[model samples]
Target: MARPFLYRCPITGNNVQGLTSDDAAAEGEKSRLEMVQCLACGGFHLVDPAKGPLPPVDDK
Candidate 1:
């Protein structure tokens, strides 16, 4: 089985799962700054993988 693409909701700080790669791809197709409605926060946020799973922590 393939791992689902997970994204972090910056508003809620929750992990949201994309059931399939196609879903993630569709989001990316829109644009890098495409906004996705967060199921957790119920608000729109950018679908940014850079801020997704295992993102680096800013010590500052």
Candidate 2:
């Protein structure tokens, strides 16, 4: 199976996977900023590959 594309939630620093390039492209085209709600932190954040992979932050 193909590995899923992953990104980090800028707000909570949680790892978010299962997002495909097509998904990002569609979102990017729709808005100036592609924001996604973090399932871990429940906060909205931007996904940018340029930021690199970020380690998950502890909420506590």
Candidate 1: tens digits of C-alpha lDDT, residues 9-43: 66666778643333345554644444566778788
TM-score of each: 0.48, 0.41
Give per-residue lDDT, candidate 2, residue 59.
Answer: 71
What lDDT does model 2 reach? 0.56
Estimate the TM-score for candidate 2: 0.41
Rate residue 29 of model 2 by lDDT: 58
Q: Which candidate has the top score in lDDT? A: 1
RMSD of each: 5.6, 6.5
- The reply for model 2, stretches above 4 Å from the true place, is 1-4, 18-33, 49-52, 55-60
Tell me the tens digit of each residue's lDDT in model 2 across 8-56: 7665555776332443345445432346656777776676543445666
Residue 7, model 1: lDDT of 83
